[model samples]
Target: MNECTYKNYDELPLMLNVVQVAAVLGISRAGAYELVHSEDFPTLKIGSRIVVPKDKLREWIDANTAQK
Candidate 1:
């Protein structure tokens, strides 16, 4: 995966691809794929592509972080 860096969430695109997600979360590409495949993750299937909304990803991180 190509390296991606964002100074803040505001720099993120409205939707994130698997590689972007991996970069944002500092996880491996395979780890990102597994995360997107998880039942509770906020993912959208646009035709054959899978994406995660930036806002939803923020909310998900907030929600899950509080649990840990």
Candidate 2:
């Protein structure tokens, strides 16, 4: 992945695929998949594709960070 091509999560499209989520979270692709599979992870399934909504992703981050 090109570091130059990375976008801030806030600047990403409204919906993000797993790879983009991984990039923003700085996690491995497999870790991103695992996160999306969690019951509490914010995700939407369209047919066979799983995507994370940008707003929900931010909400999830906020919620998690607030607990620390």
Candidate 3:
């Protein structure tokens, strides 16, 4: 598990691995796993691999930007 905090979503690549996502979100791989299960985060399952779409992530950020 790793922790990361990416200040700019635009700086993230279009496709990111789970570990990278975890790093960007400042969460551990386990926490990311939980998020995937809840379907609240953006992820795409290709075959047996999980990938996150940067654009979708940006949209989610936009939606949550003003949250308290």
Candidate 4:
């Protein structure tokens, strides 16, 4: 984590929207939604939008990458 990195959830000023998350993970929007509904996925709801924390996404990416 550099200066752009966030140490806490509160420190994160923006979140990766569903589409962005899907894009980062190379998945479709429907796939992202499916993961969102699954117990395996972590998410947050703010009013009407669902946003995934960048750190959580990074963790997910790390886990998956390590599997390979």
Candidate 5:
């Protein structure tokens, strides 16, 4: 797995661009772009750029993860 450099999600900005989201998620830059275009992934398109809200990302993760 790729390593994430962020200390905590709380320290992240309110919204993250695709590159930032890729770093946070430890995914490839291309993969991040792919995710942004996926049906269920949350994203905001600003002209040619795609971004994700921090809170929505957290919620999506929680919604998708299987409960222990």
Candidate 6:
């Protein structure tokens, strides 16, 4: 997966694929797949295609971000 050029949430697409998710999270494609499969991860399945909503992804990050 190539590095994501997105510097902020505004740069992200409304829906993101596995590769985009990997880049956003700075993780490997395999890792992103694992996360997408996790029960808590936000995802939408449409006839065998899996995608994440950018808004939901941001919410997930906010919810899971560690407090200083």
TM-score of each: 0.90, 0.84, 0.72, 0.66, 0.86, 0.92
Better of 3 and 6 by TM-score: 6
Which residue pairs does candidate 4 place in steric collision?
Answer: none
Structure candidate 6, residue pairs in collision: none
Better candidate by TM-score, 1 or 5: 1
| lDDT of each candidate versus the true structure | 0.94, 0.86, 0.77, 0.70, 0.87, 0.94
Model 5 quality (TM-score): 0.86
Name the best candidate (by lDDT). Answer: 6
Evaluate residue 13 in candidate 5 and report its C-alpha lDDT on the 0 to 100 scale.
Answer: 91
Q: Where in model 3 is the C-alpha error above 4 Å?
A: 1-10, 66-68
Off by over 4 Å in 2: 1-10, 66-68
> Which candidate order results from sorting by lDDT in descending order?
6, 1, 5, 2, 3, 4
Report the error of model 1 at residue 47, Å: 1.0
Report the candidate with higher lDDT, 1 versus 5.
1
lDDT of 1 by residue, 37-62 (tens): 99999999999999999999999998
Q: Could you give candidate 4's per-residue lDDT for residues 20-48 as a string of tens digits? A: 66666667888888887777676888998
lDDT of 3 by residue, 1-68 (tens): 56455567666788987788778777888887776666577889999988889788667768878867
lDDT of 4 at 2: 11
Report the Cα lDDT for residue 24, model 5.
89
- Using lDDT as the yardstick, the better of models 2 and 3 is 2
- Decoy 2 TM-score against native: 0.84
Worst 10 residues of 3 by lDDT: 1-10
**Listing every candidate in turn, what is its Cα RMSD in Å to the true structure after a full C-alpha superposition?**
1.8, 2.3, 2.6, 6.8, 1.7, 1.1
Instruction: Report the C-alpha lDDT of model 6 over 1-68, residue by residue, as the tens digit.
Output: 66888999899999999999999999999999999999999999988989999999999999999999
Q: Which residue pairs does candidate 5 place in steric collision? A: none
Worst 10-residue lDDT window for candidate 5 reads 1-10
TM-score attained by model 3: 0.72
Q: What is the lDDT of candidate 1?
A: 0.94
Model 2: number of backbone collisions: 0
